[model samples]
Target: MSASVKSPRDPSTSFDDDVWPDSTDVLIMGGGPVGLSCAIMLAQRGVDVLLVERRDFVFRFPRAHLLNPRTMEAFHDMGVAGDIYGATPAHDRWRKAAWYTTATGPGRFDGMKIGDVPAWGGGPDAERYRSSSPRAFANMPQLRLDPLIHRHALAAAPGRIRSRQEVVAIEQDSESAVVSVRDVVTGELRTVRARYVIAADGGRDSADLLGIELEGPRDMREVVNYHVSMDLSAWSEPDALLGHFLHPAGGARRRGTIQALGPTHYNRDSEEWLVSVAAWMVEGDPDDEAALFASIRRMLGLADDHEITMHSMTRWSYHGLVAKQFRDRRVFLVGDAAHKHPPTGGLGLNSGIQDAQNLCWKLAAVLDGQAPDGLLDSYQAERRPVVAWYTAHSLENANRHPPIAEALGFCDDEAAGFRGLEVFVSETPEGEAMRARVAAEVAHNAHDYSQLGVEAGYHYWAGALVPDGTPVPGDPSDPVTFHATSRPGHHLPHVWLDSATGGDGGSVSAHDLIAAAGLTLLTSESAAPRWRAAVAAASGNMPITVVAIADDDAAWTAVRQIDDDGALLVRPDRKVAWRAARLPADPDAELTAALETILRGGDAPAGDPAEPYLRRIRAAANVLVR
Candidate 1:
């Protein structure tokens, strides 16, 4: 049924003050990637979810162009990764970005060559726990991807996504959140009282009602983005998405041409091929598609025989801002509502998708009464800092002018700059190193998500899972460097464990094992007696899994024996909650303490190594020696 048809509100039926007839466990105020993702995950957990969008349909503008590995893993869980992969054309995966002097100038710089395969890893195995796949980024535009996810979310729960329904106001209390939405087409007003309200409204009209302010530079720069149809196959250039034009006079323009949409070529006889171009405007006429096309043709040195088909044009402002706060009572802001950044590094959409994944599980746990309210605080604690860091870094990146533009060889340092350029092009080791260093400086930027800690190494400092500052003897740096480690606040690094038990002979990832269940306890087999008892108690009381490892096993030796660590508690999100050298006298007390910390979102108890808990395990000696 069309979303414009509003559902009638009945006055005869009794409804709670905080909730209405169409009220659900979670009400998502945005049908973009973030909101849709939340709906997909919440529905999977059996929580009734409603996603409302202001637009009539998914937007077709290709805003975001990169999807990171972390987001891909989330899609894998939702069972739509394969569908997205199949629907996306192969050419879309092979992207090439470059820098140009102007809309019609020669090339100046090229994007760091991201190889064909994902730099970290791809596929189902990459999603395995403890498996930190090597691939980092994928070149997929949001215009094509958002629709796929929206369809999947609706399929997961039909009649849940209500487009053309704009949220007007929100009222929240200690019990629930009530949102008043209007059906734009029917002019009908309906109130939905939900257990939780998510503000994924992307800084549009809805976020304003919640008194959320997006603080940052609104107009850092103005960019013109448009999709145009033109025939340029005669140039015989490689099918690279990004092309750079450098005008001898000065100023530059970057064009991204999609030679083919997915696997199929545009019907040349009926419809022309499309290419997107973005030019930095100093000041001039906005509706200059003819001038833009003429510039492109001059840059490509093509004849005037090509026809121009202007599809859509949009003017956007680059603003890097984060909301004042992500949560205020039962209303929580996410995605663009939480943060917005420049498209320099293409981190905006990926960051929002991460926000959704981070918030969904916490919201579900709170609704199901599995976790305490404090868990929600981690969402802001973890993501807000990340958003701030990336935004700053992106602004820095955008401000960096190309070496060619800075030198202005034809002017002031003309001779020295030309000489330097000659030296830069030399084949000597120093020359090669100079060019490589410049490329490396641009490519290996500090935009590494690892630094933010939200994507990989974020640890809970104030909440229930804070660990006691016990000194475990192991290389702290190694955890962040070589492989994933179950360090406090860091995602447990993925490792391939022997899958002999499952008759697969292949390897299973650590993530798949621990993440399969809610909370997991990894303990030594020597402590199996106490561990099994604790497991029995925990199983009866709460959702938990206990994995016992023998002292002699190599895998156990590598993990448990390293710091003489006897056991480690992993949270549902795959972060370490607690650790001990040996089981406490009353295992339930320790288990309860750990569970309470996680549920309350408090740090684990702090204490000195109380002799037994601090004892070191010796494999050769076959004894726990303090």
Candidate 2:
């Protein structure tokens, strides 16, 4: 049968002003995307969950613009990606990362176009992105994404989210744990207990409650975001996702960048924007509003009186901090509580959503008596390596920026001026050399922009999945390329499957065939009869679905890494738990052994040997930790 497509529903549930529950099956701290994702994912699995947030309202900061394909695929499974896709701007509205000497006015430089490249996973590379996954990277910011996720979370778990509530205290033993949550609005205290606690609190306190130390660099550097609104429709601005306004004297701190907020056009409709500039440029002892206005005008090459409205000025730091351990007894850290990264790669949020996805299923299985406590340990084993690699990756991306200035012949302090840029763009031989150098540097920096491998190709070397002992497919070291395979511990390769008889005539992603809350056994027609019978016999109290390929799904079967008479078992999170290359003589016994290894942690690592490599990766980062 074709995979069933779930229709969207109204998230009609409300939790504001509702009384607190004394207990739940799961307690999720923090109401950011990660916590909400945890609540939604867990509730859909029939688990009672309570999500707590310290803020009284959904945060409106317009941060984290890129939703990578892997994160989008997970959101698609949760039923919220459709609405996000519908609301996103068209491709042309945010396709390029174009650099400029300035946007307009040409006060110091003649508004020369420095360079251009495709941003995110679109434009000339669109096919590469499309072929890798079923979804596109949405250039949706949190100002739009968070509220939608909050609404879906309400629907997924009605009367379960409590804003203006914070986890003040937490203590856990082997049996159950207690968390003291305080109502920030009413100054009232409430106590709740849960079988498990997830600290997705974005480095607020839950990790502190467990006394977990953050390993690696602390404060790398500081940058300021100026949320301003202006009418740039009169300027000669072209389409771009991000506009890099460059000038040699600007230094790394003063080089300005503009992020498109969007409504079909960059200048005509993206009236609001977030600007990155040096903190010192806008900082003054007496608060020089006139000078600040001038600095903004100079950055955009606008005249002195350009009528820009300043909404908010936020100053934040970049860090490469990872919690010493993600799991401690019954409390597990998810999202920022577990790891922090610089925004250079726009991966902080994408990795957080994936963290929730990885953790919630293991939680559901254990709570339902379907898995062992040892299975929970796999969360750290699978995810910590990713956390370490990304921390280094993001810091490397941040360091890649200043070299662009150098490549444009900004080496000497005296030569770093508008005249230097003019000569560099000339048709002279010196200009050609400078252009080549700039292109090489920009291409190097582009790794941060289109890291499809880091986004999708990441896998576990030591986790819950039963390894086939074959070498792990794909270059785990390459952050730009993704190699699809059905190796255990890797995401099941995505392929469109034709419908089975007595089913809908449409084709769907093989990933969609797996249930959100169960095990799914995918077998070919040649192996269908025994696999179905074996699943029926072995499913017992667990939710397991059996799907037989329609014999013509060459695309789907080719990536299975299994024989026509073999089968693959997919977990609730769509991870391939085990694969049988060929049908065994006793089908029931084979299926039973696979489930035992997966759910019971039959072949998981005995210790955290991956940590030494992770520590080395962290130490090698070019980050400045205070």
The candidate scoring highest on lDDT is 2
Query: Against the true structure, what is each candidate's TM-score?
Result: 0.76, 0.92
lDDT against the true structure, each candidate? 0.57, 0.75
Candidate 1 lDDT over residue span 1-626, tens digit each: 11011221221222333334666788988898888998888887667888889887647676675565567667777786776666543543233333333222123322212111111222321343123532234545566788888888877756777788899988888889888998888788999899888888886865668787766555655565655556545432334444433333333222233333332432222123334444432224546666666644544444555666776767677676777678888888888888876765556887888788778877766766666688787677666665665566556545433433333232334355445445555798876766665455433322331222323433333343656565433443221233345555555555445431435655555555564325677766577567666656652223566766545556535544234325777765566777665657777677776777666666422432111211211111121110
lDDT value, candidate 2, whole model: 0.75
Model 2, position 358: C-alpha lDDT score: 87
| Superposed Cα deviation of residue 566, candidate 1 (Å) | 3.0
lDDT of 2 at 102: 71
Q: Give the residue spans of candidate 1 off by over 4 A.
A: 1-20, 87-131, 134-137, 229-248, 251-284, 295-308, 400-464, 468-483, 500-506, 524-529, 535-542, 548-565, 581-586, 603-626
